[model samples]
Target: MKTEKPISEGIMDSLQMKTSFKDFNSLKNEADTLYLKFQRMGFIESELLELKKENDSSYLADFSLGKKFSFLKVFYSSEDFTKKELQQISSEVDETYFILSFESIPLSLKKLTAIRNQKGNAFARVKLTDFEKDENENLSATLFIDNGNVRTVDSIVVKGYEKFPRSFLKYYAGVRKGKIFNQKKLVAQNENLNGLGFVSAVKPPEALFRKDSTTVYFYLEKQNNNLFDGILGFANDEETQKLTFNGYLNLELNNNLNYGEQLLINYKADGKEQVNFRTKLTLPYLFSTPFGLSGELKIFKRDSTFITTEQQIRATYQIDPRSTVYVGYKGYESSNLLDEAIAGTPIDDFKSQFFIAGGSYIKPQNRKLFPVKNAILLDVGIGSRKKDGKSEGQLGVETTLNNIFNLNYRNSIFIQNQTSVLFSESYLVNELFRFGGINSIRGFNENSIDASLFSLINTEYRYQFNDGIYVHSIIDLGYFENETISIKQNLYSFGFGLGLNTKAGLFKFNVANGNAQDSDFSFSNTKIHISISSKF
Candidate 1:
């Protein structure tokens, strides 16, 4: 009883031998003899076979493999067959493997008669059309992925913005809608909307799948959060033979008024008559609650020696966009006008009220500017101060560290360290830990060392020549201590600098020559230090 012709008559006899192949070179010699019969059935060696000659009534065989060995020999089965004996030897080698595996070769005989009527199916669903490859090549990838079902996230569009605030870009793009379509959370929400400095580009989310979800769009590019910055500087202080002129001005207002609030105003001047004024306000989510708030008012003067005033208020908590934690309240006042031939010397005059705590971690390699590759800052505090009415007890500690070391793509190697301490046995000359010139210890004189304790270290080796120009070579080391001027000091400096990273920030010029000693190093002193700054 050997009679069984019915899977729709074997798909109508494979569509009549797929329309009697009109000999295009005998259908490329029967597709190179069915590519050696699918490599003798174990199918491996493939060099992306080709045949093309598609005009004279068809013949365009271009078979390819290596999408994981062509889905394991086209959906597996070959240890001497038996996936129903490899579907009866793949339906007698699927008409010469659909005339050498298709380029629409008569629609691959209706996909080889639907894989021989889905024979002994363990898995089958092959749909490939014009695939592509060579993405920094490991070669084997002619697109083939078929483990289905799992999409979700149906809806999230958000193209270009005008004034930001689609609830602050869906609250910093922690993508929501229905979940599950996470490609590493959409590339970490496009790097948290390009680190939100009013976003200047964020693309890469375009999803769109659909038969039950996935719509994601997100393309953004917005910048210009209103800012104005200015600075002009000139210096020459060879052991205080002074000749300095510096000026700065800034005004900013980010996020329009959409509640991610920010506003700043600053002014500085110096030709040795130093003056500074500041005003700030930042809110970034205080009431919406991811906690953040800032307030500041500072006024500093430095002619006869000091005149500082400050009022700060801070609160911050963002534990993740690179860490932060803060707390603050500072109300200060210092007014020492030196000159009574330095009367009663510890540089006096003060008023205080402080309560501060700080934290910062920042792991930035590039996020706008600065030579940051890693940053850490810490602050400790305790306070209670009242000048003449006597109340005392104050303590403060500060620390900073930065390290960078990429030695390619324009070389780098920077290290910075700063340390401060004040245990107040009467701490005022503008809170005391001063360190000298051009951002500290640069061959002295600018706040020329008077300490409660201080330490500084800077080492640099930059070298970038384009895009925000750079050139550096610096080394500075300083240490100062004061047990009420029983004093101990050490300073060493070396330098070279030229930087200009702008959009309105980071401009520098430095020159330093060393020497400063005491603790009986015979009271040494050598000079040469120049400085300039502009950090918008």
Candidate 2:
């Protein structure tokens, strides 16, 4: 007849396998295996003490204390333990061990060190050790949730602010109570809040269980107003034909207002002086209810070389919860960069000024085609242009489908098309930048095109570095047909190189190869650009 025994009795019996001989060597061997397993799971030598075997001819043992956390002991003893009995013993041991707790533990450490796996005597720890501590000893927490599922929180309890509502806290929550939650999704929404440049740090919700059901809570820290920033740099440019010194001032005013604003002004000089000024006022909560409003004005002057001014007003209203519908108006006038490139005949002779007013509906999607993170965008714009005896309106569509579907990597495909009037042009083909420098056909020259309905299919693959720098490889393909130059020269180019896009604007340096038709006519096209924009 078989007799039922307590779990401890079973464990103690297993330890007594060499009891008849009291084999210290066999006992030490088993202890050694257990020690190695613990060590692999991050328990160091200092955390272990003495391990001893019982003197009797029985399976029994004990370990001295020094473990990082408290533990419970279960003994297993069996004269002839079967496979099924060992499996049962393991299940019982695990179920018993997980309930043990240590007192006076930091919450961060507690949350990250949960046991993830146990194979016999071996185990695995799930989270990284460094994740538990912040620079100031503040606890770091992470909460993961499935995409597209809503969670309800009864009330938000904040500790730092005296003039905000629980709902206002929801804005800072970077998540909504009834909205679906996904880790990447929440981060994107919170990033918008961060872009407002008000909060110093924002953290996501922590999943907790009360009575066997799961819930989430968020924690955040806000920075005070009056922020100051500066930048200084030296650059040499082949396009500008000058080596220049650059500096700027970035100021944030009344950051804690519904209508937040920033001021940016910069100066640059090589053999001459240039000044650029830009400012924007944003209404984060325009009339409340997830609607936004912003206004921007910019001016640039460079002492008889060039001068330009632009004004814009944009507003976006959230639609379908996960996306927005936006409409904006912008007007700008600027001198042509190729004023001297047009056979040295000042290309700026064509005065250009236009007002663009258009509406677009955008949807945010997760998971992309290919492993790269991308966005899928569909934009349609209608506007009027009054320049060079061409007073006409334009209709256009721009697509960034990669950004919608791929949300975790750096690669994109962009297709932009514009349909116009006041001239008879191809409905589907007007302007196209097939290849060259950075955005499109990469093996060719920069802005090396004539005219038409141009369609550019450009792809860029970018690699990011640790010290705020990145490099990219680009491909550009473009074609244009001028009535004067009847023979259409379709250009293709491939380029690869690096660029520095810091707090400073783009200063790209690349080497490219281009082909106009079957001829291999290419040149080194480099660009040195700068902007003291307070925002990325």
The most accurate candidate by TM-score is 2
Local distance difference test, candidate 1? 0.62
Tell me the spans in candidate 2 whose CA falls farther than 4 Å from its real position: 1-151, 157-174, 177-202, 207-217, 221-282, 296-312, 320-322, 328-373, 376-379, 383-452, 463-470, 480-489, 499-515, 523-536
In candidate 1, what are the lDDT values of residues 462-497, reduced to their tens digit? 888776778888788877787664667777777687
lDDT of 1 at 489: 71
Clashing pairs in 1: 82-85
Model 1 regions lying over 4 Å from their true place: 1-316, 329-351, 355-361, 364-385, 390-410, 413-427, 436-459, 462-472, 475-512, 515-536
Go through the candidates in order and give each one's C-alpha lDDT: 0.62, 0.42
Per-prediction backbone clash count: 1, 66
lDDT: which candidate is best?
A: 1
